[model samples]
Target: MENYHLTHEDGKYKLTKENGERASKVFESNKDEAIKSSKDFIQNQGGGSLKIHKNDGGFQEERTYPRANDPKKSKG
Candidate 1:
């Protein structure tokens, strides 16, 4: 499965593939908008893993799109 990330940088939020230097999308809105857009983008790409980071530079959470695509071994 593909893995993507949503991170805060340069006063903007970005969605990028894992370890990518370039953003696939840039969120000019609030974090809420960034999260929603990232979810849609991942879902449209056939679902995948998304790692979200807090503005404090710490890991926030991880989401698996489509719900059913979540790994069986992980409960959270």
Candidate 2:
């Protein structure tokens, strides 16, 4: 599974793959758009994790695609 990251830089939001490799496009100033784009890319790749980061470089949240890969089981 690949890992995608959502981070803010230079007054804009960026979506990048592992090791800081640039993603397809740049999000000028919208974190929402960046998150959506990251999810779509992960879905297209079959499955992966989207890690959203705060402006301070701390992890905000992690969303897994396909659901099965999630480490914490959801109680029904």
| Predicted candidate 1 versus true structure: per-residue lDDT over 1-76, tens digit per residue | 8999899999999999998889999999999999999999999999999999999889999999988999999866
TM-score of 1: 0.94
Look at candidate 2 and tell me the lDDT of residue 71.
Answer: 66
Query: TM-scores across all candidates?
Result: 0.94, 0.75
Positional deviation of 27 in candidate 1, in angstroms? 0.5
Q: List where candidate 2 sits over 4 angstroms from the true fold.
A: 72-76
User: Residue 5 deviation, candidate 2, in Å?
Assistant: 1.1
- Candidate 1: where is the Cα deviation over 4 Å? none
Per-residue lDDT over 1-60 for candidate 2, one digit per residue giving the tens place of the 0 to 100 score: 878788888888777877876755578857887787777778888889888999888999
